[model samples]
Target: MTAAQFRTVQQPLDPTAAVGEIALFDAGGNPLDLSGGGQKITSVKATALAAGTAPTATLANGVLTIGIPAGAKGAPGTAGVGVKSISLTKDTDGNITGGTVTKTDNSTTAITVTTA
Candidate 1:
């Protein structure tokens, strides 16, 4: 008696489901990690300063003055020609209340200050 042989069959590919939430890619087109506990993202509003076209202020005579709108309170005034160390005093609210400026070098230095 001769035994019957069974033929092997190939399965058909299913193409019904669609992909959800496409993965993010970097500038080099590489997949980025989107898992939890990854890098923290902080967003700042789009301001004039953030744009690259903003005009920068000029530094004159070793002084860098920032351009703030009028009626705005300016920063604390600084004294002394050469300041090296700064002393700070904190208030009850944990804010800096006072500060003292000291000269960078000793007064006995050979460098003389000539007043014009």
Candidate 2:
């Protein structure tokens, strides 16, 4: 849901009923100068996302792209389910030595790789 908010600036009226054109009163029974009929509003929100499959996005240059990458398309056929989770063992280093990936059938796949 997108919405806009504006801060309301209002002044209280006087205690006595001696007014003519809805006199503007402040908190201390003072008149207010609302000559400027323009109110300062927050920011207006953008619209919702377009209709389509989910996509990857990137935020840069004061713009948010919530769709497929530029000039990039989906590959043919469906992707096979594999590697739901991976647990890698590191030797005092942040290099990816090897990891285990879980499949959709609750089975784990041992993955061994050398990083140099």
Number of colliding residue pairs in each model: 0, 0
Q: Candidate 1: what lDDT?
A: 0.39
As a whole number from 0 to 100, the lDDT of residue 49 in candidate 2 is 46
Task: Give lDDT: candidate 1, residue 41.
Answer: 26
Q: Give one digit per residue, the lDDT tens place, for model 2 in 1-102.
A: 111222225566565974323333334545444356523223222334444643333223333333432344557997678656778877676667777888
Can you give the lDDT of residue 70 in candidate 1? 34
Error of 2 at 2 (Å): 59
TM-score of 2: 0.27
Q: Determine which window of 10 residues in candidate 1 has minimal summed lDDT.
A: 1-10
Alpha-carbon RMSD to native, per candidate = 28.6, 19.9
lDDT of 1 by residue, 1-116 (tens): 11111111344544575322323344454554435655422321221333333222322333322332234346899765675676676669876666665666633222233334
